[model samples]
Target: MIDFEIPADVAELRDRVRKFVDTEIVPYEKDSRVTAHGPTDELRRELIAKAKAAGLLSVQQRPEGMSHLEQAVIFEAAGWSTLGPVAMNCAAPDEGNMFLLSKVADADQAAEYLDPVVAGTTRSVFAMTEPDGAGSDPSQLSTTAVRDGGTFVINGRKWLITGAVGADTWIIMADVPGEGATLFLCHGDTPGIVIERVMNTMDRNYVEGHCVVRFEDLTLPESSVLGSVGQAFRYAQLRLAPARLTHCMRWLGAASRAQSIAIEHAKTRTSFGKPIGRHQGVGFLLAENEIALQQCRLMIWWACWHLDKGAKARHESSMVKAMVSEELFKVADRCVQVLGGIGISDETPVAAIFTDMRAFRLYDGPTEVHKYAISRQLLRDAAE
Candidate 1:
């Protein structure tokens, strides 16, 4: 009994985003500023300028009353070009940072930190994961922030922190003795923070590549604490569920774009007296991709629907993220296979898309971790 139709306004926005991506963003795929780390700040700014000129930048930041369901429609369109999300200012970890700050930051804090990020004037980082520390299991966080009169002295090293090098805002999670986990919001150049290095990762779609960072004797006033002591985990859930779902939404667009490129290649490339698309091999792969693409889209919509209804959607998002990540990677791989040598080469975006899709499998949370979490929930429910 669920209506599958998108609201007219959402549909129009989605189409506009898609067109902006194809016409304005796609041509920058070969831009020199795009590096192994990610697109340079200069390239990102130019793309943002174009999107802003077209009235297509930061739709997520506007007060247009777009719902979570509406975001699913728009984010997928932005994912068409890897740069599209960057241009639209909806790319993570900035996007997720905006959501977290909006939910928890005070008016003054939001004005100081969140406003610039939402406006695309600056980027932000969520510093959670650490080397040999929190990852699939956030409870293992070892970063420390000890109380010192009216301030907290923080010290820790965090790796895989996206956009940390160029970020202006930082949301750091640390363990406070006897107080559990806490979240801290601080400026990126807060004296004690240091950029260790930018990790060279396979996926280069982000504005700043994954990075290693350290907070050495960083001190901040009590006002730097986000919500409440020991509530970092709760706020993390608030960000992670929706952020994971949005990841699926954006990557779904990349997978779909890959499928489109592969299909066109198949249609034109003739072999064995006819186009290869007429043969079963490439044809069947495209068919499976189409099915997976639709499934990914539907799962995203279903999860977004639950979120819009005020549900946390933790289980729904975990399952959707795990499934969509795997399926989308498969679609990308199939596209590469269909394209033969050109697939692995830079001649087309299929290679980059495939690499990014593969990284998506491990980005938010690895598939095995999600499966383990789902099983534990099932066992816990059964025990009751």
Candidate 2:
């Protein structure tokens, strides 16, 4: 039988994260420091300081000891406020970068590039998506890193690079002529790396927003290579599977927050004779939201359980990410509808959550891509 119980320690930590998010982070929702692009580095630093003081800074940094299932619980709590993940330093790009670094970085690289980020002392960017046909398909990667005597010179453009504006570290993906694609870890201010501009995106939960970057003969020593050459695609799967699952976990929390707000609005707002929640239309939506949230939680836990057991969980994670992203978007949309006019306005974060939820459906390999992958796996199993 599958045990549905959360261990006492994990449950306690979850409550702590929930309390911290609600009390410490939510107030910053209206902070002017949160710009149209995204929260600034100064704002991020201030928030990270709060989480550090609260003793919540480094839990996710130590990926080796932490349980993936437990991470789902903590990440969901941190995700309650969009800024909650930011405050706790479990936000994406950095969190995923930590995972990749933990898997591949040697001692020297970890010390200079990864440790400070894990400490929440610095922000990092992952440069994988390109302006051309490479967003969803990494094979379409056109970035080149040519061997120049002792150092490799990289030249390419990467866009939609999250947290690039004021980041301290970077994980760059480029193709070596004969060795295939590889990951290169470099300092943010490394010569030849440029932050072209911040891209205005629908979502604003990220620290520096999405950015366009160009590598103009960015050169790094052979030691800059993460793991062995020609192994990045393999390592990327290692990073993406778990990272994708965590996305679902965090967004699940955001959608839950939106649902709570909608339910409360339904409880107090009057329609014909009584509270609108009494109306079947509004009440049904709340019921649907409850059911969808539970589904999302279960899917997340199931996938995470596999990862905790040392399962690759690639297929499971794809299924979970695809299903949860779509379902949570529906939950957020329904919540907005239930709130009516107030939903469209910034009166509550429901609207913002709705917007982010839509974007989530597209990121982490869009729902269609995941569905395609799932189908391909099933077909392969049948053919075998």
Candidate 3:
């Protein structure tokens, strides 16, 4: 009932991307210090240039726009290598920011902020998570953007903001009195914008370390507002449906790589004069990993297909995110177990993959949050 076969054109694109990752990105993985967040600016620039040369950058954004299925395939391929997403210019926070900007930014705003991002010349951050609150609930947004003269003065503290250190711009979400929440585009260097410190996370290789930012009367022009005033919440909700699905696609690729490593280790690594893979314990664990990977792939494709039909996949996205993150974490942990000491050490990517997958449960709304949402929706549907 499900077709996993990609179109010929998309298949070609996938192969091309896979080749690029194998040749250009995987080499960097050997360096434990390379960090998962991605390459430095200069290094990123070089990689982006290489991606452009290969016609791989910006593949997520087609000339006529992209179907969800197409974007999923592209991101899955990009996720093959940890650097593949960055190299192809389809990495997160930036990708989600670009998607939001494309939907709402005016021509002037697009030319100023969005163009440079697409060209890979500038980076951006989405500052939404707050120190005290505002993690899972957008309504609890505490940052305030009050209008003053012809400008909007923003004041708030945001933490765990991705890409804050080296970002050139930001799309900040803040509360507007009486009007609800709003989105504003502000320059990272704007007056009163303060970078508290880059919080070291489990995954340290992020291009701009996860940072805590303080906006002390940061001001923006009236024109800097993204979409309608008081519509920020709506925009955010819309953006996350696709954004979460994309994360699933990318993580699935990473999980597949981990599973492959584990399978190979099982086949060759021997104990008691026989390959350990022959043992039911090891073989069944490997089989479970494979089954989980396939199950995630199917769920992701279903969500992507729904998105392509212009359907709001809020519930579906939540389900897939919860499912994939949990499954991937299990698979990564299993890989580490299968490889023994080598898996736990930096000798292989299993350890890092396991660490990274743990955070996936926290970011993008967490598993508990999604479960609550799904349950609420089911109850509402049943009552109706």
Candidate 4:
């Protein structure tokens, strides 16, 4: 049996987060301090404090617990505003990192890294995408971790690493000689780790900027390795499966908000004979937005249900990621079109949402990559 209903308890939590976002976080969307690189530490702390006071911070880690399905609900609410995830302590890199650490890190490591992040006091990054190397393709990883006695020396350049500028810790992916790929934990300020530049990007809500970083002979003790050596791909799969669905959950929120804004504009704003929404062209767009939003939500929940059941849901996650990323973008696009000029302008968040949603397709995993993985699995099943 399959159930799509939100339990009463989870609905209450979702409502709480929704109210907090509407009351506390949405107003900060226009703060000049909320830069392209995201909110400053002071601003972030201020908002996080408010969220904490409201009992919404780290809602995913509540003692009562949150299943992946429940997380999809609360996270969707948090995604209503671009800052909602950050304010609620459920935003990416950190959200994904916390999940990774809890599953893989030792107690000491968790206290050192995950605790602060879960507490909303620190930030972290997963360093995998690199320039001229492993972007969507993990096999092309060029970063090397050379074992020297008890320590390993890491050397490589990683680019477009989100939250790299102000991160306290990094989960670095590097290739070990004859060991495939491995994960390493290191402080952001580790000697020889350099931030070459913060890439100026389309969206600026990531807190730390998308960065180009160089790990020039950075060293870490053997104890710093996360999980087993040469298991980076497996660990990443574990992280990515849920992370990808969460991305859909959050972006779908953004898309839903955009659609709401467009609906409002259509209802009140005037046109030739009546409200612009009366026009078939505009009405159909809003209709499409609603249909797409519901579909995206269902896809996310379906994948999350599988995950909660202890399935990796590799193919399901891939399909949802590829579909929702592209579908949500369509939803955002329709919202923008329905708004006309204001949609593209910064006067509204639709433009920003549209821009962010565009990048959503490329991150996590590209659409083409997911399709390839899905087809490969199908081929294997057929052969079997």
RMSD, candidate 3, Å: 1.5
User: Model 2, stretches more than 4 Å misplaced?
Assistant: 62-64
TM-score of 4: 0.98
- Candidate 3, residue 335: Cα displacement in angstroms equals 0.8
Off by over 4 Å in 3: 32-38
Q: What is the lDDT of candidate 1?
A: 0.91
lDDT of 4: 0.90
Model 1 clashing residue pairs (backbone): none
Instruction: State the lDDT of candidate 4 residue by residue for 1-384, as single tens digits.
Output: 877778998899889888889888999999987887767767778889999999889988776777899899999999999899988888888899999999999988888888988999888999999889797888899999999999999999999999887788789999999988999998888898899998888877778669999999999999899999999999998899989998889988889889989999999989897999999999999999899999999989999889889898999999999999999999999999999999999888999999999988887989999999999999999999
Candidate 2 residue lDDT tens string, 1-384: 999899998899999999999999999999999888778989999999999999898677654577888999999999999999999999998899998898899999999998999888899988999989677789998999999999999999999999898788889999999999999988988999988888989998899799899999999999999998888889999999999998998999999999999989999999899999999999999999999999999999999989988899989999998999999999999999999999999999999999988989987799989999899999999999
Residue 118 in candidate 2 has what lDDT?
87
Indicate the TM-score of model 3. Answer: 0.97
lDDT of 4 at 103: 94
Better of 1 and 4 by TM-score: 1
**Could you tell me how far off, in angstroms, the CA of residue 121 lies in candidate 2 after the best superposition?**
1.2
What local distance difference test score does each model get?
0.91, 0.91, 0.84, 0.90
Ranking by lDDT: 2, 1, 4, 3
